[model samples]
Target: MAKNTTKNTEGQAPKGVRKPPATRKTAAQKKAEAEAKLKQQQLETGEGDNTPTDTPEQPNNEPTGETAEKEVTAGASESSAGQEGKTTETDKIKSDANPPVGNSTIEDLSDDEFDKGKRDGVSDDVEDQELMEGQMKLEDDGSTKIGDNPMLTDTKDKEEVQPFVRKTKIEKTSSNVSIKSLFKEWKKDQALRAKYRQEAEEAIKSGLPAPEFEDETTLRFDLAIQRNETWTDYQKSDLIHTVLYGYYLQPVLVEDSNDGKKWFIDGKQRLTTLMTFIEGQWALSKKTKPVYGYKIAGFKFNDLPSEMQDEIMDETITLVRIKNMTVAERDEMFVKQNSGTPLSKIELIRAMHSELSEQIDIELSSLKFFKEDLELTKKAKDKFIDVELILQIAMLIEEGKDRIKGLGADNYKEYVLRLKETEQIFSDEMIEKISNISNYLTLAFEDYEMDEVKKALKKVNVPIIFWTAITAMDDNLQPKLFGDFIRSFLISGYSVESAYGKSSQAGSSKKENVLIRLDEMSAALSQFIDMIRNASSIEEGVEQFNKHLADVNGVDREEGEDGERESA
Candidate 1:
């Protein structure tokens, strides 16, 4: 069962070309050289038949349609081995890999049309039609419909079509006249409801749906109104008025199974609004609206007549039941649906198909410093800014400035997108490095019992300087410098300029600004270290540091000399 390890180079060269006597390489080296030659040939000819064994295996993260296309272009720049006339290693790998059918091949695409195909080696199991399933179909009147086309047919005892494409669009029908009888409340059995909740929570944690829950309701806004903490009074009022005016609510997407269980995919806002009104959680706004059946605009559900209440209940909301889509695909639909709506970066990250952001967030949250010690406003959890800062720092350490050239809060939306596309960001080694940074920070900060140090560290720009400084120092010596470095750095004029100057405030997130700030802080710390090394006493060191600060900040000490910069 032993495989052949020898290279068969007998007739590889073209006719009339005299072969040079081969070097006395070992079998492994010979095999490797042969592969290199084969790869070169494939790249030159755009022939992907030759298999290159040296290429590293791509990670298992599957990109959606749009991102897959991005991979093709990104893949080109990713390959360092490309030559003047040769196709990129990404092209070679993609040619050999099982690309999703119907996707444009590497050879057909120009450099501009490249998909970072290198990262998309894992073939998507979800079929092409399944991907196109929930795509919004526009009607003549301008309403968006989900599941407008019947992707699958239920005709029994008939020949199944090879490639089914629904030719007929699902037509819109008038709303039911009898309000109370047309629609029923989305009620699930007790066991199914519990199961749905568990799955919904898991989806909220990570976009990947639970095994059994994808087919059933993931989130029921009617039953789960208490859980949505972000729904505002103004938003609820708008929804109530919207319903009272008899405007058609957007179709709520659901995954309906043969067993008749329904799982919600989108339209939670509209659904929650309707239910909140019916339950009398909030009355209609003072804005005049009695158009449906009500006499007064500000009537609660109970204050309305029985027929009016029945009319609201019987009002039909459109339902788009999905089938044949993967859990990732399902999550993608929700993300796309909420694309225009205002949402936190972390919330959007959770709805994404990748697990990297959520995984990193979970990891950061587990740290005691992140939970209790670090000063976080209540908005931190909702806005997820804490995790966002952690991720930015993690990337700063991981990618270095060459890759993250434009890193800052200004381009954070773009930065995170690229981070998701990048496979190396979430490696076990990288995650451990982040953990080490966190541990270093916790130990270095917590060791000092001074409340002043803790309060100073809570400021926004301080951690960036502290973290950058600690990371720049010798690992063993980082803890030693923490207290002195923090106090000294805070007492510098540059810290105040860096933290509060108009230039710093306006350009705080600019790439050049971030680099300059870090560089100057490092320069200041380097001086402090030099003072520590040569000065005879702590008093002498402080005096030297105070004098050195003016020079570091490029301010003239000849005109004025101060004792020390004020601590934050």
Candidate 2:
């Protein structure tokens, strides 16, 4: 007999804070629940939640807040996936045993006490202005104050530091790049998103497909490495490892197609990681096995991200090499900004490199050629590039708005264009920004202090890689692109899938197979790395990633579930 579900109506909805208000926890999805919760909490409020181990949705979204909640959240008892009963100390997750997740905040965050004291995180000043521009009420001096609007309090009470601006007006260019185009071109996920996956359960009940062999592309990411202002050694290693093994190593369609419906071309990193993971490298010391089982049936350290490994097992690895896509695809994937945070990291780096080449000839300051490369880079590249790295630099240099390091209402981008002229801010060029950055990275790795809040450098092994990949690009005034990253990554997962159930498909080849999303975990990680390391705009990067995530799972978020504060 089925038991009845009851609801109390006096004033409360339920004893617990259930997002979707459903109860179906599996060995893996259950864990995803906790991960999902942590990711969301971190995003909704720019800090790790440190709720008691028993409550998944309550506090300290900090990466190292409490393993008790992550490991013991109602359904974690099924497997011992390194999910110990309790432990959320300042130390990394488990370096030698599992390459720790996050550490406490005690090390340098690259800013002195005076600087840190003056900032909480970046203010949404620009975002608020964009939202309330014509509608804003001003004082006699034409300045907006916190007392004017209550909503502005979120940006002000936080004590965020407003960044200095020095950019001229943004030259407007015309294009058909709609919001949808921003997130275009990835592997074609023709499958019936969550519905098809959910049907696996029914398929099994009908005695058709097996549990372990369902669509392996279903992915789930670790919340351990998600952070912004601060990071620890474990967090850094996890970031690099997650990228190397998960997304870069997974099997994906890399090539582009004529029709918008199809996805082609997979990333190179996806191929390399699979070789080491699934193939088992038996001849080498690692001695990898060539067998496949439940998500991560036979791989080593399978617990961490076995779900994605399973997806790789299901698909055939094919290389899609195209020097330059045909006219249209090239326009879409290579240079398109279909998504908010599209290819900012890569395109921006290339843009930065391109801009530095000319070095803004002081003698030619009167010539338009001086900043032509920088300007054109923005127009030519997709919005995706802008969202990631470029956006981060904006947050860091400006008001720390991108990273949430300063306070105020969001006027960042406008401020940059109006006052922070690009040349004047960075000596017309910011030199020596990278050399010693490597030294700090090495120090972080060798017995370093940590941030429990931001989980700074917790998983890094190659800090220089992050420094160059993320920084070393065009300078935009903003703050904490890192915080944006944390919030967006989680929002992507939440918006994509909230309730887990059987696929609605009637007769899928994957019928009877337990729908799992392990494969996409790597993709998520890859996109995250590619975004953080290469995107041109933080807003663009988040949008693109979220869209790609939706494509992978067939679950889209409402328009405002998560977005750049341009509209506030």
Best by lDDT: 1
Task: Provide the TM-score for each candidate, comma-separated.
Answer: 0.48, 0.19
Per-residue lDDT value at 437 in model 2: 34
- Candidate 2: C-alpha RMSD after superposition: 43.2
- Each candidate: RMSD: 32.4, 43.2
Instruction: Name the TM-score of candidate 1.
Output: 0.48
Cα TM-score of candidate 2: 0.19
Indicate the residue-level lDDT of 497 in model 2: 36
After TM-score superposition, the amount by which residue 528's alpha carbon in candidate 1 deviates from its true location, in angstroms, is 3.6
**Shift in Å, residue 269, candidate 1:** 3.5
What range of 10 consecutive residues in model 1 has the weakest lDDT sum?
114-123
